[model samples]
Target chain A: MKGKLYGIGVGPGDPGLMTIRAKELLDGAQVIAYPVKKPGEDGTALEIIKQKVDISGKEVVELLFSMNPDDEVRKRCRAENIDRICGMLDQGKDIAMITLGDVAVYSTYMYLDREVRDRGYETEVVPGIPSFCHGAAKAGLPLMIGEESLAVLSMAKHDIGKVEKAVDCIDNIVIMKAFASIREIADMMGRKGIPLSNATVMSNIGMEDEYVGPLETDRKYGYFTTVLIKKKVN
Target chain B: MKGKLYGIGVGPGDPGLMTIRAKELLDGAQVIAYPVKKPGEDGTALEIIKQKVDISGKEVVELLFSMNPDDEVRKRCRAENIDRICGMLDQGKDIAMITLGDVAVYSTYMYLDREVRDRGYETEVVPGIPSFCHGAAKAGLPLMIGEESLAVLSMAKHDIGKVEKAVDCIDNIVIMKAFASIREIADMMGRKGIPLSNATVMSNIGMEDEYVGPLETDRKYGYFTTVLIKKKVN
Candidate 1:
């Protein structure tokens, strides 16, 4: 018996943002898996789906994968954990690993996808609404016009210089995973004449905690933060 | 009673890609509006949702809009149609206009969003799955790494040179709406020493018609297309 793996993106924390495909996968899958930073911590992806759909029906699997930064530790844990996941698949369990935003962009699920592929298991990825798209939509701004260049950057390394170069080059820039480095981004945008007022910062988009407005200097950044800088179309 | 207009995105002809919020808007709104090139033509947005959702409970509104390059004709038609949509809102109809992909990414809904704002009618936008994200996911490629830049472009404009410049400078490029000038892009990408075999082109992502593979020169481009050129990671 062979089992299939699904990388399903549930979109940013708004349940309504879950694509019809994601919902179907959730309802039909034999096992619904989600990553948790530690036990009992709220999952950004699971929270998004739980809001609208009753996920209690599926055989839920919680994969405790800490986001701590030890490369070797993560690799080892992921390998061992994936082997366990594969063991269940060996029992003909159709599994789904739900994620936030699009699974291709900055998703940890890629590691598992690679594992499944290397093990000769079939896998498919279901796309979801990206947080940046939601931020741009809420801002009432055009992310790409006739020929505008768009870019998405992660500020995890906290490299202000590299981020500045990106902002300098792209016509429209979407910075994601940028909580720790929001101040540097804001300052660079201001100095580059990008106009802080023109930029929009959306935190927890599409959820009750959703906040969207002119870039605020005082707002503390979080892992879920996204900033979209587009030249104000006059 | 003045009703509000919602510009919602129905992602890339896949019912599963439609966000949970987008589904709610599509179902609960008094009118579900969508754009079409000609009267009675199958609307992309409506067709996506009609598969999984029974929208028979909602009144359908078709907004006939053309994307012809003729400036005067397009501008005039857009203004008139927007006026008509606004009138529906004024008549106490809560209308949800569905656009393919995210409403803010090179989407016609952005124009409507601006027009509605300019007219002082309160409007909100619900974002959907972006085709570029979907393309990357379907192709099994990561869009960007930490501090890495990703550029998205369209090939219709003569400004392909400018796009090339950005692509040259950026780490990854996702070109959308490139069905018409794929050869030119392929040529430029090849000149840049970016392996065409490594470059993934996805069309109709998330839909049954979705196709993803390495760039093949013999293949003809489709209307809904995305080309991703990713830097080889060490």
Candidate 2:
């Protein structure tokens, strides 16, 4: 029997947030794979699952998925990772590639899952709680209550105009990867008459060092940071 | 000691998709409350949990949360529901209010949760897998690739212009409540040069009768239907 590839979302920094199916897959899988920016770096997905499941007997593979912007570089990295994953599947080893959040939402596993499936391998994606949802819950913010629309944007590639439009129109906006352009986004929201109080910046949610507060444009934030903006009630 | 209110997200139709925390809370809670359009109606949240956890001895209360547009009627309904929940909490009965999909995103429980919290009761929100994430996974579609932005809109209350703008600009769009305006939204996407092939309509995901296919505007869909559109590659 051929082995299957499971893309399991570990959820945002919480072991309890992981679905029962994810935990079951993690405990039973012979080979566990998680993405890392570098070979020696610790992966968040691995860290989250480690808290709940024992990985002492499983073969843990760190798939290198760099944060490089160069397409050629990223393509090469994905190719190598896919090759390694396929090699394991060929050995009839069921591999579970754990991801930080939901696999379908801006996850590196999506690319790897697509490549594996295109090569005629069985693949399954188990949805986990997305980070934005966690951020909203932690911040005690209601994301789109009663007829409200929500726009989730990654600031890494979007232009300022798009960000402004989202803030102006959408009832709730979640800006991911807000590390670099958080100041700029805050300024834009200010220009658009969006109150600073309406925006909450949360970093490392569900972690010991989690930070949740009003958006501060001047402060530097880590990559795991997210800004949730709820339109002010008139 | 006053009992706490746990707002649990049951996820989309699948018993396996429920988080371990949600299941634990469901099993331990003295009272289980779920929203319904009317009393005696079986709610989707209740149905999903019924498949996994036994509710034989637990007090099951179906809170009426009608979809009526009249503000006065909705307000009164919410007030009554809050009163009942507070009464349970006052009696030191831990109440677990189950919602379909994530409670933090577009959930009726948000209002009830806020009301409970404001009335000096402890409330905790456990995130569950949102329906759109499940829909994307079931359809084998990536919601946001790389730095793509995602917009989640409810067509039940949004105007055509807002929907058109979202389709035109957002990299990924998930349209909920597309039952009434699925045809119009399809036409708008077509006019915006977005290929119909890029859109997938999924209904009752993870359920036995789940439907996944290319967006067919001609077909009538139940309210559980969702339209996921990934922007056409240039």
Candidate 3:
């Protein structure tokens, strides 16, 4: 019998935030795969679940997902990841591919899941708390209220003009990967009449060194940083 | 000693989708509160968690959240709910207020949480899977990938022109409460050159009677229905 593939979301950094279903799947998973920025380094998804689930005698695969901006390079990396995952499935080992947040939202596992299913492997995606949601909760802020809309975007890919338009049109906005563009985003929001107080920048959410407050133009941000901008309530 | 407030998200509709934190809170909760459309009706959030968490001995409070479109009426109702919740808190009873999706995203519990905190009561929010994320997973669709942006809005409150602008700018869109405006939105999408194939309407996600497919212009949808539209990859 061919082993099934489970695309599990480990949630934002907190193991306590992990869903019961994800925990149950992790407990039973024989083969676990998680994305790493580089070889020989542990990924955040794995680190979050390690304390809660025992992994003795289990096969763990480190899938390298580079931060290269080239489409060809990323495609090649995804193809190789699928091949390695399929190989484990051929050995009749059920593999649980862990992702940092929900697999459906800008997650590397989404690409892997599509390829795995296209190759005729039975794949299931288990949802987890997305990072932005956890960040909003930690900041004690609501992402969007009744009748309000929210726009979630990554500053790395979207044009500044597009981001500005989103800021004007949407009631609430969550900008991911705002490390490089925080200054620009803050400037745009200011130009759009959105006060700095309405924007909350959170990094390393649910972690010991988490920051939640107004975005500082001088502060450096890591990859896990997210900025939430809520339009002033009228 | 004053009692703390736990704003728990039951998650879409599936008990299995609930987080470990929510379940633990529910299991140990002294007072359980959930919003109902009417006094005698059981809240959807309560129904979703009832099977997994034992609530036989818990002091259950049914908070009426009317679906009135009038802003004043809704505000009055919310104020009444907060008063009642504070009453429980005054008795030194920790109250676990249950909501359908993540409390941070378009949840009534957000309002209550703000008011509870303003009243000097300690409030804690536990995250749960949002309906759009769960619906996307169930339909084997990615909410976003790479740098693609997503806009989540409710059709009921947004003007058609604003919705059109969002659909035009955002890479992916999730429209909640699309029941009444399904046909109009479909027409708008068609005019904007977004094919019906790119849009999927899912109702009652994680429930027994879930529907995931192209939006039918003729079929009537319930309040639980969510329409997900993805921009065609060029």
Q: Higher TM-score: candidate 1 or 2?
A: 2
Scanning candidate 1 chain A in windows of ten residues, the lowest lDDT window is A204-213
Instruction: Using DockQ as the measure, name the better of candidate 1 and candidate 2.
Output: 2
Residues B34-97, model 2: lDDT tens digits: 8888778868889889988999999999899877779899999999989989998999999999
lDDT at A66, model 2: 73
Clashing pairs in 3: none
lDDT of 3: 0.86
Best by DockQ: 3
The 10-residue segment of model 3 chain B with minimum total lDDT is B204-213
lDDT per residue, candidate 1, B39-145, as tens digits? Answer: 89998788887875678878898887777889888888889888988898889999888888888788777777788879988899888888787776776667764
TM-score of 1: 0.91
Candidate 2 recovers a fraction of native contacts equal to 0.70
Tens digit of per-residue lDDT, candidate 3, span A1-234: 889999998878788778888888888989988888788886788888887899888888888987788979988988888898898899898999899889888888887887899999999989888999889888888898877889999887646787887877788999988878888888898898888878899897766667888889888777688999888752
Clashes per candidate, residues 3 or more apart or on different chains: 9, 0, 0
Candidate 1, which segments miss by more than 4 Å at Cα?
Answer: A66-70, A206-209, A221-223, A232-234, B38-41, B53-59, B66-72, B145-147, B205-210
CA shift of B45, model 1, Å: 2.0
TM values, all candidates: 0.91, 0.96, 0.96
- Supply candidate 2's per-residue lDDT for A92: 96
Total clashes in model 3, counting residue pairs 3 or more apart in sequence or in different chains? 0
lDDT of 1 at B223: 75
